[model samples]
Target: MYTLYYIAGIATIISFVSNKEKTIQGLKVGWKKFSKILGTYLKLLIILSFILLISDQFIINYLGGQAPFVGLILGLIIGSITMMPGFIAYPLAGILVSRGVNYMVVAAFITTLMLVGVATYPVEKEFFGIKATIWRNIAGFLISALIALATGILYGEVLI
Candidate 1:
């Protein structure tokens, strides 16, 4: 769906550039616009990547070498603070798992990261009405708890 939207946007821009009687060529204009947008996103990505790198090292040191419970707490705390897109969250979770973090806790952290965002409450309230947003978040948190429990049980079974 997002890819389709991106393709549609690119097509629209190309058509518009072709129609325009510009001093520069159509391809040049399109490339310039695309490059500007890409550059902006890349800059933001670089900044965020640095923050994540520093944060992971800080968390690992703070939690000690082998502490799954500490990782769970720190992950949840970071998840609550960080508001990057969901796509980034999964890869981060995978990295944490590979580092010997608990899978169930990562699942809970991911759930809470997406579903129980205090930062998004104002925007959600304005769009969906205050009461509706509050109720939905509450329900989402509850479901996230159940998912965490199930994930823990499943993983424990494998360990045993």
Candidate 2:
């Protein structure tokens, strides 16, 4: 993480040296956009944490070995609703798998979390229209489901 910060710092310094005014303007724009995103992301993260903490056992009971398909479905639903960058989402997926969640579930979770945008639907709709947003999400959901199914078959004999 510190390495990434160092690299970004170096890049920023280079950019600033090349064009101070442009670099400053870029930083200002980035900060403004990032601040809004950070607030919403943090709020969603908190809500998700509570949901996970409260339902940990429920998750284990349903999504562990007993009812994996149900677990996968739940994963797709939650993942679609979630809005987080890959850096956070991937680590969360690792933690989930470490906790004994099914591989298929985690696959669906990660895939849909990256591809689907239920939490961003309103924003997307504003830019792309409601119909396009809905279709895009549907496509993402279906693709994630297929990926989960493939993961199950390849990794777990889950579909067998």
**What lDDT does the true structure give each of the candidates?**
0.65, 0.80
Write down the lDDT that model 2 would get: 0.80
Query: All candidates' TM-scores?
Result: 0.55, 0.62
Candidate 2 lDDT by residue in tens digits, 1-160: 9999999999999999999999999999999998866765676566656544534355445455647788889888877876677897787777778888878998988899899987676567766899999999999999999999999899964856
TM-score of 2: 0.62
Q: What are the clashing pairs of model 2?
A: none
Which residue runs does candidate 1 get wrong by more than 4 Å? 1-54, 58-78, 157-160
Q: Per-residue alpha-carbon lDDT of model 1 for 1-160, expressed as tens digits? A: 9999999788867776777555246668778888756654565566556545646555435433435455555555555445567787778777767776677677767887787755566556656888998898788677766676677679882242
Query: Which runs of model 2 end up more than 4 angstroms from their true locations?
Result: 1-66
How many angstroms is residue 111 displaced in model 2 relative to the true structure, after the best TM-score fit?
0.9
Please tell me which predicted candidate would have the highest lDDT against the true structure: 2
